[model samples]
Target: MRLNNKTKAGYFNFLGTLVIMLFIFGVGAFLLEYFVYDYFGWAQWLFLIIPIGCITLFYARGRQIFEYDSDGEALNFKNRNVVLFLDKHLSDEFPKYKLLKYDVVNIIILKRLYVSISSKKSHNITLRYDISYLTKKELNDLKFSLSKVIKNNKERKREPSS
Candidate 1:
């Protein structure tokens, strides 16, 4: 089934990047300026703009979709765009992949499709696109193909399974 990317894909990514950039800049400037020298002086502000004008390219991106057959298991997560940020370990524990922007993904069609993708640093970013982004045919096909998995996602995890 054909799926659409997040409605505010650029904006959302921008916001996320901005937050990350600020944190990185804060730490980096402190380290370099404090340890290295006070050489940065006024030029430090210009250096900060590097992150501002950084890349916002979305490569190999098209309609994102999923299949029910043998999905959501322990899929390899070498290169993927995660959406839900479900697994804490995926976000917190893995070595960061850089250069590439979400090439391949290990998907779990949970309450919503959780795309497990990596970010520039060791940051694991998840972007969720709801059914509203799907076309009528694709939505129907998704429902028909994996209704159970979708339903299962909606159930509260804290509650015991019936």
Candidate 2:
């Protein structure tokens, strides 16, 4: 899915916040050096490194796409390989098909986002992704595609036995 400017803005916002915090701490350290003591100067530099490292790591990880086939199997993200196994079964009260019922539920829009998918077997899967670099349209499309995949898998599993 293509990422939009909104998502990019979100990432920038996070990075911006981190930079601002580091700057503030650096300023405080400078003041301390002038008025209090120079012993804590290293702390300011160390604090600044953390935010920079985080920003670099975020960019390096790149984007992630999740795709599930009609047979209730998920496509391996890294290798684009098909995984022909089920990790765990949902509980009795909630069936596996329940995951297909929702259009979208519990979506948090931010740098780090969390989504919840409830299965019919009384179990739920929580998907966590970074959306700070995606646009609103891209995010919506991704969600829709995921829902459709889940629905298709559910239907496939319900076919009558021969």
Candidate 3:
């Protein structure tokens, strides 16, 4: 199984550009109203407030891209911020038998995936990924895939090798 949010990359890029453009335009308009028109009103404050709010929302919500692949002998996952050059990427690949447990949290607007895996050097390692852009069906599919891996791992541990 292979799943990724690559299809939404263009949408996020366009939205980021639009929000920035809006902020610039709003500031420009506010300056024009203040200096050129000598206007002092509540509406003028909205020019600054609306754009700033938009920028804040965009920063909070639409920043990460996630990818998951569960083919062959190992599971692969990748996560990175929308700004390619600025933020570090999270990438992991571990064998199926190493998987311990997994959880998915879906709140009002935030969605995240947490996976626990056994490590040779440590007791366990936990990985986190943002799944905010995934639809409900896609999220279900991801959960199902992780659950299958964990279940198989447990069963394998129970069976004795002959």
Candidate 4:
């Protein structure tokens, strides 16, 4: 599925982050004054710089595009800086790696989350990453392609290994 991060979601994410940061600071400042009995009025506001700066960086980083291709069996991530392939089916081969793919196989669709593929060896959450906003066509195509992979895998018989 070819998709880029949604500009609207990034903006909303920035605002939401700003609001949460403000709330956290407000609470921290209030607690400091009440317990410490120090009347450091307005001085506590300096900490606001931390959240503003961090959110600004995060929002800027979110602009990079991410793409996925089930037919090609690869996902372009890290702001398209790196390519992740989908062919390495675990089948419980590497327990450590499966631990991570537990969350890597999900994508967003129509503002809803869906797991395009998952492992029987891992217990992953349905809700996952927020990047990769997709078109209806792309989403449908990815779903269809993933379903075929899942069906084929399920139909294959297991063999005893040495």
Candidate 5:
């Protein structure tokens, strides 16, 4: 899926909050240092800098785009990808029935909190992400693309039977 500029801005804003928090804390630390450590040593300043540095690095690394594919594969921001194979317990519980294909599941946007995809067979998957990053148009387009992929896959499956 294509990430629009608004998504990028949302990521930046998420990280920006951390930077702002660090700046505020740093200022507070400086004031504390002057009041309590002026006659002592520079140890407090060192302690404060360490946490701020760590927080900045953590946020910088966390900002990225996420991609999910039709086959329940998830590609994270770090470029790591994994296929979500159904577990044996789930498979046994939800035995596949004719005309009910788990792989035919498509993405569904629910309210403002959750995104779910469910197959005709009842197998389902859901993800919770910061959707506030997406504009209405971008979200609509993404949903359309995902739906099309799912529909195509279903069509391919039916073609073998025909």
Candidate 6:
């Protein structure tokens, strides 16, 4: 199965633009109120908080695009921030048979997928991907896909190689 949240990238970009516009509007309102009224009103606090709150929320939830491909013999994963230069791009690919286990952490503001794969050096390497932008249905599908791979790996190990 190949899964990607590419469609949501545009939505996130739109939201970012909206947030910036709101911040600009808020600043204009703040300046107007200060210059015309000569005193800060109670509503002024909301203008200040609006942009800060939006920034905090987006930062906590992350702004990365996550793609997972279980096609062919290897599982591929790619995660990169919407703002390309803001963060380094991350990509990982490994054979499906080496996948030992996987876990999805879903907290109120944080969502992440952790995959553990057996490495050639007799150690397990864990890869993490931000899944905050994924919808609940998408998240469930991802979990199901990972579980299927892990089950197959376990079953393959149980069978003796002739």
CA RMSD of all predictions: 15.3, 10.4, 1.9, 11.0, 11.1, 1.9
Q: Which residue ranges in model 2 land beyond 4 Å of their true spot?
A: 1-73, 76-125
Q: Candidate 5 residues 65-129, lDDT tens each?
A: 33333332332211111112311111111111211222222234222223444556776655343
lDDT against the true structure, per candidate, is 0.41, 0.46, 0.85, 0.43, 0.44, 0.86
Give the deviation of candidate 4 from the true structure as CA RMSD.
Answer: 11.0
- Which order, best to worst by lDDT? 6, 3, 2, 5, 4, 1
TM-score of each: 0.23, 0.38, 0.88, 0.32, 0.35, 0.88
| lDDT, candidate 6, 31-109, per-residue tens | 7886787476787777768887886788678646999999999999998878777678889999999999988888988
Clashes of each: 13, 11, 0, 0, 0, 0
The TM-score of candidate 4 is 0.32
Predicted structure 3: lDDT: 0.85
Which 10-residue span in candidate 4 carries the lowest summed lDDT? Answer: 86-95
Model 3 earns a TM-score of 0.88
Candidate 1 segments whose C-alpha is farther than 4 A from its true place? 28-144, 148-162
Candidate 3 residues 62-85, lDDT tens each? 346788999999999988777687
Q: Choose 1 or 2, whichever is better by lDDT.
A: 2
